[model samples]
Target: MRGLSVGLAGLAALGWAASALAQDVRPNVLVVLVDDAAFMDFGAYGGEARTPVIDALAARGALFVQHRTTPLCAPSRAMLLTGLDAHQAGVATIPEVIPPEHVGQPGYTLALEPGVMTMASRLQAVGYQTVMAGKWHLGSGPGDLPDAHGFERSFALDASGADNWEQKTYMPFYATAPWFEDGQPASLPDDFYSSEFLVDQLMDYLGETPGADRPFFAYLAFQAIHIPIQVDPAYTDRYVETYAEGWDVLRGQRRDRAAALGFIPEAAPLAPTPDRLRPWASLTADQRDLYTRSMAVNAGMLEAMDHHLGRLVDYLQAAGALENTVILVTSDNGPEPSHPVGEPGFRLWMALHDIEWRTETLGERGTTAFIGPEWAFAAASPFDLFKFYASDGGLRVPLIAAGPGIASGIRIDSPTSVADIAPTVMQLAGAEGAVADFTGRSLAEALSGGAPAVYGADDVIGFEVSGNAALIRGEWKLVRNLDPWGDGRWRLFNIALDPGETTDRSQSDPEMFTEMRAAYALWAADVGVLEMPDGYSVHRQISINALQRQLAQYGLLPGVFALVLLGGLGLGGYWLVRRMRRRRHP
Candidate 1:
């Protein structure tokens, strides 16, 4: 009887200690991820997008000046959530860009590898409620939804992107929009609009909580400013004349603002416009009108997303959970430059489906459009290139972290990766021990200005996506942009002094360049980065994948029939030509 009484007393004391610790720590975590936005698209970052909600967060938190992510969606999100390199997380590149030859390879699986720990799972193990809503592009197979990745409640879309106004796919890679609710296939409501519907679902999730004792991690990823840019008329009305000056002037203006705000050095030269980008003065009036309206819709979509975000902020405040919550806002990658409406195959597909794509209805429900490369270049002001390449513009993006412990109104200029987000969140939640698979360190101390540094000057970070490559160590960076946009020659630059990569110093400093090249070779081999075949490009790869899908659907009969019909037509044409020549000679 005496031993039983002592054991009961000991158990009671431990329970009390655990409860007390929970009460003393653990703030709710809210991560807001937007899609396909450039570094300066947010108002706080010096662009025309009216993101009041994000600007306020920047004012109240720390903005990371040199934050980088992969050049595309799946890889960036994989790193952000797992704190592992894109290859380490098993999403080396998006499924659209993965070559057929490398489809099932270790790093090209396009799914989270077994044993990879996600931030949600880590937090859930530590008594935090995990919830997610909006884009979840990681995977869509069994055991691949948000529930499998540690989210207890989720309403997610498992595609690169979807239509903002309906449950339809925005790209050719997917046949339908793959949406899942709590691990089961679900459908979107009839009244769907990307930003509004996402918040509505997330708010419903947050409101279902029983009490304030248990902290929650809510991840809201908006498909705003992505493909088929749709928004209310009011938001678009504000930017009708905003882009009239065109990309050339807008690029210079944004560069000046970045310098004034100390986002870039004043002496750093702006990158010369690429030869592919046509000047505004060379455009016809009709072309100018079409491009301007496209940009207007793009800006409007961004503001519409912010408007919906403000509603969520209001709800959290009304629930008395705003002040204690940690809010981190960032984009998956830089601006999207693909123009599907201009493609012959895409136009033919629309025609076959009886879909109408008109200029006046560009931002409407049935129409699909994109800003293409010219606007994407301007969106990434002062930087060299846009998304889908390994340039600074493609990798560089804005990151703002605001919460209970972080300093307000400050900018951290240190180099950080998207992978750092997971460890940083775990550190803030006091759930570090639950995570044992992180390849990134916490940036909490660095953001707070209380620690020395997270990365050493000698540490090398190598990045690759679809064979585009870059390696950075301290202030030096080595890059190789494949054929179309570059000469495929390795170039070195002092990025700290020239964020625009205006000068290549590989010829001037041979020894350092050699060392960095050797380091990149080792890193690539370790990460399972495979070589791209000769004459490969992401655009051509996408076409190949699309054609493959069509062939699989129709089988071998259609191809054979078409080939025979073409051969007969060729023979008939040759006979007709020969007869005409004989008659002329006679």
Candidate 2:
């Protein structure tokens, strides 16, 4: 027994030495991505959600207060992995939102171009074991799966989002969940929840070939708090009365909290409530009840996701890999604004498919729910609009990075975009040379010792989605928010001083606005941004895209059958008329 114990101790020491050596070479990268979470949804960012795991991570890492992602998911995900502008990455906008005229345009291909290398590919080139789980909306089909892009093992959902608890597509744009495992069609385990299932799959991948001496890059994307915001009943119960006061009050509360936390200037002006949103006081009791429950479900989803994230962190700690791993937590975009469950097309489709949105099942297995524009507006807090617009609310999101070399308990106020993530991760993995030439700057300097700025005063950064556009040069930002959100007017603001974008300095600073506009035009031309058709509306474009898909899938078959049936009826009628005429003549 004594001899066996001595042998075990020697083996343990050898294992420790191996792990230490691996840490010295390259830190393991753990990217925790959440879908459609608002800027202040997590407790770490000052919202009411209980996210102890994420908060703890913020405490140990740099919290980027002004970080921005594209206003939607796919484009942001593309930028995050490729370290390039969304247009340069070939996903200028989501497929469902792309107009037919713009479908095959240079930057509107709706998928990452084949030659574009991903962060995973860059890291894997340098001996890292790259693995990914959860959402992979960059592309679809066998050739587009994560394995093809450099992940050695991947369990990916190639759609925007799907049902959290069931293996089914949540939106009509997808016919199925489109889940895949290492480039092959895969099935979900019987017991599944997006957050838990993603973490478990990543852990499984990490455990395979355990003795191999290689660092890892794990991208764990969660479909939490997206549409169909379901969570365990226990989690939902905790926030039952949390949002009883409604979005109006919640918006003010969150705005104040953000100012207090220095996320916004102390005197930052609140953006006016969008004209489309109905006043909370005008809602019926049932409407208020349903909306309130939906908000609770949203919060519950975040808390549940955080809890599962903690489980993964705990596992890493148990394996003695936590200290050597760099973990980043962020959202793909801002709060979702579309209320699909209430759309005319959605209701018709649900009726045809025999699905219903029962209040009792609001956040349960078979029902769908969302926070609507009102709550989404509040969720974005002091920012101007929700998802699908270029307002700070839609683009600015939380970015937390913690691990071996990152500075602790600090807030990095420098402007950072999702495009910077790939280069930053490559730097941390010590695979800088492996990465392709990209536009984003590395955040290494800012992460360790504070850098005054990541971009030079003359360097221009531009963003565009659907039709909304914004360009930032030094302290000035020139923006255009299309229809419903704005009057389709060009505006300007010194974002450095007025982050909420309440005051437009266009009239007051014509010279700066003119310069910024020219810069945006130049950037657009360089990136091959296509012109939006006149009267292009994102909401209308989505409906048209859905119609196109339906026609492509089912319209042709039914239309052909109808034509054949009508032809037969016409022939019979002609024969009857001829026979009747002959009888009359005889």
Candidate 3:
């Protein structure tokens, strides 16, 4: 007995040393990504949205007060998955992202380098299953897709933005061409809302995927509440009668309610809704009813999503995987404004920050949307601009992490970036040789209620709206306007107290302003996003010893069906594209 105890201690110490040296091991990681949502939409973050499911998560885990994602989806996603800044990966702008052909060569465009250890590969190496469902906007091609990079099982749409749920619709602006499901395209019509469809597919995959008995990495990127704005009849009914007055009335009410509920700061004034919208009283009765109904639908979807999330939690809890799984919930970018409420066009202008995005028309865009800035503004609190704006209002998002080893209900102020999620999950998983070329840090210490500061970032963050630039460092943030009729100049704010960014302190602090500007430029050139599929490689294979298998099998190889499923997807994709094109043009 004494000899056995000594041997076990030695083996444990050796394992610890090996893990320390291996550097990329972690627990079963689950990243729940919300689309185009700002930091304060949920009940946990003190917003009006009935996110009881997420609120439960917040109550059970640590919430990040100062968390941020890049302003757009593709670059932000790249940052998260690759653990590098947009500059380092070279995918700065959504449209400006370098093509796959332009990637991976020495001294060329930034793309997901094939050699780097992705979260999937790292987890796979340690015998964990890697599965991704929902949006895979980074790329759509063979190399660019999740399976090519490292994910063992995937069910995702490769396009960047879509609010429509009806499948197989064409999205030309997404850079990936059209989004698809499985190997074939889903025929999402004008009314086929993405939020509902995404949930359906995700639920299907979770219940049936491989390594269900093994430690797994589940990356669920939901398409809820993005564009082609949708509201199921159930949720739409709740607000059809209530929100007849348009955004001003709704914003006023939400602000009052939020402030009263202690969700908002006391002294901060409610930023008025934009001039582009019609007053509720002015719109016709049908228009008013549509607005209210639309809101109801949106809210209903939120509730439905919450219910489904509860289902997932119930599954984990029932399986006893609840204690072992570390769940992370966050958003892709800020709340995006799309279509006309009662208004005629997309209201991309800012209320106060003056960081207005150029007005665009969905007439040229692919889908239809009913609601406008009213719904988005109602969702985004304390922030100034819509999704594409570079300000904190456009970039800030809530990050909730809960599970065993996590301190519950704690608020962390460390400068955590979305890019940190991959490395953080790797650290949590205890997988060895997980990630390299990572520009982010693990929040493990902080999540566990320790205050070890996140390193490397010297208090600087960058954002871009087309060519417009915004930079945040310390308490101050700078926004450069791109509106030609205006100054096209820099405006700065102290974000700590002025979270809404109502006041500009740039004129007051010239030296500080200069420092921020220099920092912004330097960081922009120094860091970037890596577009995946550019020779990106995450070569992790599981060790039977690392898994908690249901059977006594020492080495569990993936079934042939799994191989055929992933292997045939790319070729099948090309065939589908050909078929669609033939049908369309011929």
Deviation from native of the Cα of residue 498 in model 1, angstroms: 1.4
Q: Highest lDDT: give the candidate number.
A: 2
Q: List the residue pairs that clash in candidate 2.
A: none
lDDT ranking, best first: 2, 1, 3
**385 Cα displacement, candidate 3 (Å):** 1.1
Q: Could you tell me every candidate's TM-score relative to the true structure? A: 0.90, 0.90, 0.73
Best by TM-score: 2
Tens-digit per-residue lDDT, 152-259, candidate 1: 889999988888877877655566788899988898877678888788777766655332357789899999878878887677778879988787888899899999
lDDT of 3: 0.59
Q: How does each model score on lDDT?
A: 0.80, 0.81, 0.59
TM-score computed on alpha carbons, candidate 1: 0.90
Cα-based lDDT at residue 228, candidate 3: 47
Candidate 2 per-residue lDDT, tens place, 487-579, comes to 678899988778889899989998888888889999998877887888876655665565555556567875444233222125563344334
